[model samples]
Target: MNLTRPAGAVLLALALASVPVTAARATTAADEVNYVALGDSYASGTGAGNYSDALCTRSRNAYPALWAAANDPASFSFVACGGAKIPDVLDDQVSALDEDTTLVSLSIGGNDSGFASTMLSCQYSTLSACERALATAGEYVVNELPGELDGLYATVRAEAPDADVVVIGYPHLYKEGGLCLGGLSSAKRTAVNKGSDLLNETIAERAAAAGFAFADGRPAFAGHEICTGDAWISSSNVHPTAEGHASAYLPAFTAAVAGS
Candidate 1:
């Protein structure tokens, strides 16, 4: 999509200037470190204008592949199927984890609480009803997300104790006070958009408690909101365009893990 560098990206580049560079040598005897990604649709690269399978569940330019490419790891597997819940992580993630794994990234929990499904429902309901749905989803994240995260982390760590784990937070829904037309009104669309921040904050706090790094996508998309110029977020509320993916992901991901 030919994404240009956002203006503030210079600031990120400047911050990146300070970190010491690491030589990309083989880390293990087999010579390549493995990287595994687990999570839901966001991690699967939805709305990024690219997919690897019919379910449209996998993205060709998923952040894991992007991060792994920068790290130049020995092997990488994006077992991040779409609509994966915490249970999926605990049970299905093993196929992706192995002794060679040195890095991991997770973006999950929206599905377990049914945010996607509920959001779809919100589109048809009145504002009060939509808010109620959001509140319910919030309750689940506030209450159950932690347990799910803890379990998933425990499982991932058990499989790859030495891996550096990073969790990518969900992006903002749209331009602040912006408008979009779907089954919902512009105001309701904005409301749902703002709800994502609450979700990210909770996710970040839990990630910190779990001792994992976070690739914050909020500030990266500040000013530039969904369905806008060089927009990093998709018009559909949750997906990201290829351009959006690169802008939202790039520098922060490298800053958190390996630097360019």
Candidate 2:
């Protein structure tokens, strides 16, 4: 028996046969991640130490650097800077992103909310003064920060349309019930931690609204908060230590990316 095939069917079959299967195997952004790390001090690994660049304080021990080293993605751009505010990120870092970018990780807004000043007041001044600073920072976080984050997140999404953006949140600085000889008082520590929670919540909400993944660093640094003997955060600076970046932020970021 002889089979007769339509001319159109035969032509289509030949055309399909001529195409290489390997051509269809061209890698996507996911298959070959072109990651761009952006944000402020936390993202730059300030207290983690072993800084590679003096200006940005871009530490090799930072979570972004560590992840890049471990995963060895197709490309990694570490543009996070110490003391980077929302405006700074918009002006400087967002330029690193483009259509080819697949992954992005950042922790921002703390600087914008005057977190450093608030912490300084809490550390050096009276409890009343600390409360005042906390109130100011909380007010900014609630009132001003959401709009800034929305603008920044919109810019990021516009630049890296296909990237899996992960917005990392700050960890609570102190272990509430833990012992400390003569640093911040328990009440001060509690207030600061609550402030940190509020900041994280604000960031999380904005990230969610922008369709970005939010990585909560609080749980990751749970037992390792500043007052804990085995603290992962630096007591002096209230920034994550090397171990904190390695164990806490790194895992939090990795998990967020995986889930994303």
Candidate 3:
């Protein structure tokens, strides 16, 4: 799929009503069986990546594992790798997915084109520098991440009509003023984070269009933010920490599958 930036860009905002935990509990045995997972490092749990994959990017503490542990599915296939792009997941993730699959969760497209890297380049550089880079990169990510997400979701649905697909969005990258964010500049961090949120909107839109579940990680993780105590995002404040994983994956999977 061509990943060139597109023309139209819109701020992503959606209101999701939380379903009760009891409501999301698996009713039938089948609901907990035949699970398949796909996505990039975030899905695999980077700083959390020991037994997952050989790639240094995967993590043991990542959300998918957290979800797996919570649900205890009979058959689980987690193909989340580090630095995986939309094309990468589409081409390489099929081996881990199959018709018998009852559920699939993924967090992809972040690395499809080096979004975080581009955002980080502006760190402590200068306001103009950060804005210029983010504007350019945001347009690129907005343009490309959507098409990549659309095609991927379309493919995933075709592969597993019965599966409940959980497309997760990244949480807030920066606190309001980037306060208490480890040691990063609030401005640079906010720009990169805002860019991440833009990409997340695309992911949600695609998930909804495809009859899948979209898990929003922002509000649920508001106070914790990135680097705070009980933080879910890593000390780097970019990737999700163990705390972040708990907030995002388990609850999301549970709620999403509850309706599934």
Best by lDDT: 2
| lDDT per residue (tens digit) for residues 1-260 in model 3 | 53343322212111122333344664554455788878877777775535555763656666677767776888877787777888788889856776778889888766765656565666556767777877876776777767777788888888877777888777775565736634557766677678767877777887888888888777667777654656666655367766667766667667876776
Candidate 1 lDDT over 30-115, as tens digits, reads 35567787888877787774677648368777776676666777778888878788888777776678666877888887788787
Shift of residue 17 alpha carbon in model 1, Å: 35
What C-alpha lDDT values do all the predictions have?
0.73, 0.93, 0.70
lDDT head-to-head 1 vs 2, winner? 2
Backbone clashes for every candidate come to 1, 0, 11
Instruction: Report residue 123 deviation for candidate 2 (angstroms).
Output: 0.6
Each model's TM-score? Answer: 0.80, 0.91, 0.80
For candidate 2, write residues 1-260 as lDDT tens digits.
44466777899888897675545556342399899999999999998889998899899999999999999999999999999999999999999999999999989999999988888899899999999999999999999999999999999999999899999999999988655787788898899999999999999999999999999999999999887889999998889999999999999999999999
lDDT, model 3, position 79: 83
Residue 95 in model 1: lDDT = 65
Give the lowest summed-lDDT range of ten residues in model 2. 21-30
The superposed Cα distance between candidate 1 and the true structure at residue 246, in angstroms, equals: 1.6
Off by over 4 Å in 2: 1-24, 28-30
TM-score of 1: 0.80
